[model samples]
Target: MAETLLQDPRTKYPVPPFPKQHQDVPGRQSAMQPVPDCGEDSYVGSGKLTGRRAVITGGDSGIGRAVAIAYAREGADVLISYLDEHDDAESTAQIVRDAGRRCVLVSGDIQEQVHCQAIVQRAVDELGGVDILVNNAAFQMSHKDLQDFSAQELERTFRTNVFATFFLTQAAAPHMAPGSSVINTASINADKPNATLVAYAATKGALQNLTGGLAQLLAEKGIRVNCVAPGPVWTPLIPSTMDAEKASKFGEQVPFKRPAQPAELAAAYVMLASEGASYMSGATVAVTGGVPLI
Candidate 1:
């Protein structure tokens, strides 16, 4: 048998000449041109999370789908919450099922407190108890000037990206026992604000703060809370939310000169949720393709 070449984790894909593309809000994975890699064929699990139950918001596609796949392979049953993306959600569920785990799909706008509570309840009822909660769903739009930012946009962004995190975490934490984990998805924008993405960046900053505070607050309960701050990642959100020019140059500022693939982020999340990271909390792990969060 021919030996399969393993890519050096630091240097795999070269800088891509991203083509101009666009999709409506909450874009579909199928519509993406390069079909953002979600580790469907690459990731191999070693039973790190065996028999655990997890709730992942935005689990329909992109980073959320990648995390669901990784967790399932690591021996977890997943309850996915997405916002009316039936086709995308179904595909993710199929991947989880294929990995020999229970996969539950819930569709709703998580901005509402009722829906957030329902999502957690569903996880308890369907998967038994929540061991890991990934608050990954988000909303973003780009504008050239601060003047273009609207009051309506600010409210909508905060409700989806910030409020939902609080609601879901509150709902899921009670059912979570000692050694349970919560992983929030922050962004590079939290550290280095993008003028055009001010609203989105602000939400990410809020998420980071929440992750830190919750880690301290939940310490007595033996629950760990952390955040993943990714730099430019080539996900459905890129083409859908960014302009053609911005999309093409997305990750160029990073030393790697390219955006990260969704698969590239799975390891950090897996570590945060596993027993290996029991002592890790209130930390922001940056997977920014060499862009320093510090």
Candidate 2:
């Protein structure tokens, strides 16, 4: 189904113009004009996750791709899941391997429980047990009115953004041991909802609470669970979900007034999954561009 992504260019609204150019969500790092700063050239590893294996959902590009690169840099092999951005996913895998780590790519929809289990199993079989799990795959659509939202679309949104986390976490739990880490991707919308993306905002809110609940549930098992709530960062999902105008103007609302690169958030994932965050759990690390939630 992911292969079908970006097929229907006939969206609810018109794609607007950006200051320069823009790529859609599930964007391609290669195609970006200046290119997205993914820190591949200088992310030297210190063996933080030496001998570890990880599975990063949505690892083809954006924040997910950055995390995959970071994990590889930290001495861990990686398994990247995606709907289809085949070339982008392969490019990421190549980078991981070039970093002297292994990488696996699995393409499919996470909506089905079977697909989730298969992904986990394949990771286990191919890369060994998963020591780090990053639930970063997500999608959002802008709708002027809730009545305009389709039932199918809403279900798909929740299935991919929310249920995928549940299904993957469930599958990964068996293989994870003490000191294993699970990081979920929350968003700025959780605390400050964007009226145009109510469905996405709601799922993110649920995701934040879910992260908290999972933290408590997994603590007894010695697995650390946490979340990263990133404010307006530029990703392909932007252009793909929103119109062209919104894509280029992204992050203009945040305090920083500029979109963050996925690489900017990589350190957080590395810290949470590595030795740096041994005692940290259940906390949602805010990486938003100065959007404070009290």
lDDT of 1 by residue, 147-211 (tens): 88899988889999999999999988889999999999999999999988999999999999999
Worst 10 residues of 1 by lDDT: 8-17
- TM-score each candidate: 0.96, 0.91
Q: What is the lDDT, from 0 to 100, of the residue 95 in candidate 2?
A: 94
| Candidate 2 lDDT, 1-294, residue by residue in tens | 446534331221222224455556556667764456676775667788888999999999889989988889889999999987999899899999998898889999988899999999999999878899999999788888889779888898899999999999999999999999999999989998999999999999999999999999999999999999998766667767876666677776666666777887898999999878999999999998677977
Root-mean-square deviation per candidate: 1.8, 8.7
Error of 2 at 36 (Å): 2.0
**Top candidate when judged by lDDT against the true structure:** 1
Q: Could you give me the TM-score of model 1 versus the true structure?
A: 0.96
Clash list (residue pairs), candidate 1: none
- Candidate 1 segments whose C-alpha is farther than 4 A from its true place: 1-11
Question: Which portions of model 2 miss their true places by more than 4 Å?
Answer: 1-27
